[model samples]
Target chain A: MLKLDKVNSFYGRSHALHDLSLSIPKGQITAIVGRNGTGKTTLLKTIMGLTVKSTGAIDLDGTDLSAQPTFRRARAGIAYVPQGRQIIPDFTVRENILMGGFASTSGRQVPALVGALFPYLTENMERPGGLLSGGQQQQLAIARALAANPQILLLDEPTEGIQPNIVEDIQNIIIRLNRDEGLSIVLVEQNVAFARRAGHHFAMLEKGRAVAAGPIDSLTDELIHQHIAV
Target chain B: MLDTIFIGLSVGSVLLLVALGLAITYGAMGVINMAHGEMVMLGAYTTVLASIHLGIGLLGAIPIAFMVTALVGYAIERLIVSRLYGRLLDTLLATWGVAILLQQAVRLSLGLAFFGITIAGLGTGLQNVRVPAYLSGVISIGGEQVSLYRAFIILVTILLTLLTWFIMYRTAIGAQVRAIMRNPDMAAACGIDVKRVNALTFAYGSGLAGVAGVMMSGFKTVFPDMGTPMVVDGFLVVVTGGVGSLMGTVLSAGLLGQINGLTASVSNDIIARAVIFAVVVTIIIWKPSGLFSYKGR
Candidate 1:
């Protein structure tokens, strides 16, 4: 389980995430939904400890991670696939994927899971990541995260800006990882329909605070209109 | 004419050594390390001290100087530069302060000067290292005589540069560094310890500068302020080559060193310096990002 208790995040002097508390159950997909600039990205970054400063508790499993550095937090089994799929452009597809192995206990290697899921990336192992199409890069990003052998996967808008044809493919991959691999996932998604289909739980964020949250069944259309409809 | 070119190659070799560390530190960390030159100065001092106390030769002093200066660089990163990562101007000012402090510490004999005590190989006076007898001799290449020491300098630079290239391209540590260089936050998110890699990178760069210092001590007088102009020259190479580019640093150092050598061969050192400055300024104006700047998507 991943839990944030009264967490406040800041970027230099500007407060980005207000006093926010959330509980993400293990081995399930928890969709974080909100409108643009409603701190969806900030919530993911806060969980990753990428913010300049943050207050309060961030617990992963039984370990306290609020005071840990980003790499340490990663080593502790939290893998973040950030917004924009920030893969190293100059690095080869293989190198980009293996980079996440730095946090893994088994060391740097292409996991069998990646080979099965991202055969295109495996085939173009020597190609530079920047040359890949947007959908391909997003696949490379997910493959990179899986290289960590992480217990919890934090995916920030994984399908954003992806080609329409590849979007469904990426969506299925996310669901498969959670269902088949039994990995706990925190998915920040803009497509409410996709979230409703895939997520077991939901958290509605507005102005950096969780305004409404519960099981996916309780995520009423009224709550969506109130906090996320914009 | 051939001798002048040889001289240029040797001069460029030393400049490459000095600029290599600056390029890495500045490129990876976005830090302008004013104390970088002081590492060179300390390296020369290490040679002096090693010769006087340990009876070590120039070759023997190389590793010692690297270790000594690398440790100092690591300490600086842990204590000061680490704190000033994103603050460009503050890092410049703070490292400049560190440069002065290092120079003063050397001049004062590590605070032994106040008691009117002077170490034999240290203080404000200029010091020199004797070139080995074999190195002092001239070698005939294609019926033209060339200083063996200058040739040795070129050889050492080539070896170290190749070694640096191998480490960066073939090693896991190098991958981490390159990742950080391209995108630090992303690198960290990928589970690379950015701070640890940065500290190691800083140490390695300082070690290169220290080696440069040891080389310089053979041909030039070692003084507290000898490294000051070197810092300027190193920056010139980095700027002309493009920040964070190893190939750029190598090529630019060679270009600037050759320019200085060829001009000084005909005119004076002062004119050669002026010409170098003019060339650098022209290049900057022509291509502000530099000759080999990386283009991102």
Candidate 2:
């Protein structure tokens, strides 16, 4: 559903992503794993147009989106939930969720669909985002991305800093979205256990490049200990 | 006293208009818009040229004032402020320069003359007092005398404030705007055009200042230095209210207004500002973030 060809992104003189070419097929979860500073977040940011790519072509389906602004890509069915739940602190819980479905506002049935995911949003529509716990925020963030009804959802560390109990909930949510709705996702996670639950497909990034990638069953304990398990 | 309350209310309304926009631009966008004061000045000048020179109706001129000043704000954001945003201190210095240039231009064009505004909206209820030709005269409220024009101003302000709230909370555009203010990236990821929303926000903030300028022109003398005083108070109000809280701005406006009005009677009019500032300092010591700081720093 999404393709990045020889895409190179930069932050000033430092090259964050080097000739990174990756494609995410539709109807399944695609996990991108990496150690710190390996450009995992940078890759998602590049796809979202959050960080300007120095060189490459990004195409969603067929239309080129490398030059398009972040908003344009989102409107084109590419929703990104960046690292750290970027929930508006002051906005109400419902308001935060409503913001996720901004692209859906133009459609006829999106509001109803979004409301169906978290009835609590419809329940406590006035509660601010700051009042929610980390787990709730994670749920709100993913629910928001789902609201857009996007072809691709870029989730950068959804389980980071979340409690273990909530981790299971988030894991179930991700699995359900992938299994039932055929939601395509690019989940960046540090916890292999949680990432394992979220999806079976994995791509390991190291030092600004996609070093190793394949079906989850092909990975061994040695690779996990060396690259991912700190 | 009732008199103090009346004065405070009017003063609060003025502060509300001035700082209300800043709550979003600076408080939310994190852009220290030192040029905010100049936007107010520009708004005042719009009224000066439109009402006194073009002979437009006060009610009609209000929207025109918003449009013209909003255009200036849009231009400033697109051509200038947008580039400087995020560099808080640099944007501040750059905008101050823009402000100085605007003041000098206004000073050159309008000359150093203090002229009175002709009042047209005052009904027969306001025509009974002994007042200056330009002055709208005093109205009896709580057995105390206050300028009828100022009272009328209070009503308009209340109406405008209500409208502002409705737009911020109830409207779809407002939801998008608050989203931008809350988290620009998430807002963008949600398919909101942050730049466009930002321009509209700037225009809205500056436009409110323009409305206040029309009132100031009608009530008091328009001097180059007027923007400085209003700006100082505006910064204080938005600061006291909290970074991104509309309710905080409203509450601080009343608190600061009463402090200025009551203190002015005991001390010199100039000293009132010093007293207000002292009070503000004291408040900040107790609540550094603000009266309504939304969440984590």
Best model per TM-score: 1
C-alpha lDDT of all candidate models, in order: 0.93, 0.77
Q: How many residue pairs clash in each candidate?
A: 0, 1
**CAPRI rating of model 2:** medium
Per-model DockQ against the true two-chain complex: 0.85, 0.69
DockQ for the candidate 1 complex? 0.85
Candidate 1 lands at a TM-score of 0.99
Candidate 1, after superposition: displacement of residue A140 in Å? 0.9
Residues A1-230, candidate 2: write the lDDT tens digits: 78889989998788999888887888878889889899999999889888744689998889999988888889888878778887777777676766767676465123564465566656766777778888877777877787787778888888789898777767777777778778788889887876776666788888888887777765567788888777
For each model in turn, which proportion of the native inter-chain contacts is also found?
0.82, 0.84
Candidate 2 chain B worst ten-residue window by lDDT: B121-130
In model 1 chain A, which range of ten residues has the least summed lDDT?
A221-230
Q: In model 1, which runs have C-alpha deviations exceeding 4 angstroms?
A: none
TM-score of chain B of each: 0.99, 0.87
The root-mean-square deviation over C-alpha atoms between each candidate and the true structure, in angstroms, is 1.0, 5.2
